[model samples]
Target chain A: MDQQKLFVQIALHSWNTQIARAEKVFNSYSESEFYKQIAPGKNRIIYLYGHLAVYHDLLKETLGLDTGKYSVLSPLFLQNPDNQESEMPPVKELKAIWNEVHCDLKELFNNVAPEDWFKRHNAMTDADFEKDPSRNRLSVVLNRANHVAYHLGQVVLVKPENI
Target chain B: MDQQKLFVQIALHSWNTQIARAEKVFNSYSESEFYKQIAPGKNRIIYLYGHLAVYHDLLKETLGLDTGKYSVLSPLFLQNPDNQESEMPPVKELKAIWNEVHCDLKELFNNVAPEDWFKRHNAMTDADFEKDPSRNRLSVVLNRANHVAYHLGQVVLVKPENI
Candidate 1:
């Protein structure tokens, strides 16, 4: 594999590893514990779960990948940290949403052509490039991985014993 | 402020927002739930905390910034998900470490001369530069914000229902 291919491979593997790791940590919490917040300003476990699920869907849309029935930017799925009861799905339902989103992402990855990986897609603004001047797909992938790993740390920090 | 300063300001604000968000979610879990692995093969709360603390320290060192007594790439701080018991730190200690590291990062950001933010550091490896020419201080900082936001999602997901 060439450099771009190698980077994509690393991204795929890293995402898989993070997902696996997150799944293990997530499963250990009870339903109630998953929704608990230790302090007034803190977020509940449900918020984190919802955030991940929503983000994956958004990323797929940003990359122009198919996200099935999910609208990546749906307001219904977005959480306001202050509004605990607003637009929150039940734990089981949210997990299902997460799984579905992940599945779509996997399919998108599998179908992405190696050449296509270098195609520049403007993520922040959602613009499509006529010819991607910034051939930096690998950087984007790495960015995403770094993004996931960073948040994973927060999830680990707040567990009861650690507090 | 010039465009460069504007960019840095935005980046800094984004990072601060994300760190605060993560802290909020983390404060919500019970001791057992915080350490518990909810999904198979996922990281426990402590493991995630340790990784972020260590990685942030590494980024600081990579940029030739002062990290006080913290050493980058410390093997002792590296947590292997497979060995949860060996890697977990007490919640208080982990939070302290995170706070200290974040403070160091904040200081680094505060002290950044505009020119330095745009300066191109030597690539960590040949592959990093080969992947993209924009892998400079600005890009690195931007990428770091994305990194933090991604992991913050995970923290929110795994939080316990009762503190």
Candidate 2:
């Protein structure tokens, strides 16, 4: 594969792998465990799940993809920090939207061109972007994947006492 | 910048950002909290820190860079789980090695080229790799970043519970 194409290929694979790992850890949770906090005062498994979905919603906007069906996710889940000043939907509702947003975003990633990826987006300016070209679409994609992995680590602690 | 070069640039930024975030989170923990389980019985904060360094040691070898100073990290941290059959190093000792390993590897990453990143490594075969080009050096780098982010999430729960 061409090197340019290879970047997208590796990135998407890493993104999907991280997501599948999170799904495996998450799906194993009983609905009760989903709501259970990892520690006495830590974010619950459900919050982390919703937290990841919220970031994906941000990714859709940041990457200039079509907006998701669950626009409410941002206000409910974004930057509120867990267990503070917020009420969350039940696990079933959030879970449905989680699946919905991921499916939609994956479709968006499929059509990105190498040249398009290098162009700056999301609040970046031409002069600043020209100085440091790394801050572009590809960075945003990897940033989302990193976000998923970060939360996956947290959710892994929710259960699997031995692991 | 060339598209291939841009891939390296983004990979490096994502890699460094994940590290800086982990460092901030890890540094915030007290000496006591470093040993506290992320949850009831999962890995401790210190274990996750050691785990990341161990993976970077592997990256050094796998990418044909210089070996890290601490081979003991692999036996103590890798796949051992926490509070298990193997004993772990003290937080101060592990902290030293963690910083040492990250500093060394960042230097290694600076020397990598886009073409070198595209070549197959580890167990990949020429034909199999051609069919799945994502299994390359760039993937390994991104894979490590994802790994760090995943654990960063878990360790974030260990203390500063509000964060």
TM-scores, one per candidate: 0.51, 0.91
DockQ of each: 0.14, 0.77
Top candidate by lDDT: 2
Supply the TM-score for candidate 1. 0.51
Question: Once superposed on the true structure, which residue ranges of model 2 sit more than 4 Å away at CA?
Answer: A84-87, B84-87
Best by DockQ: 2
Worst 10 residues of 1 chain A by lDDT: A126-135
Docking class of 2: medium
Lowest summed lDDT across 10 adjacent residues in model 2 chain A is found at A67-76
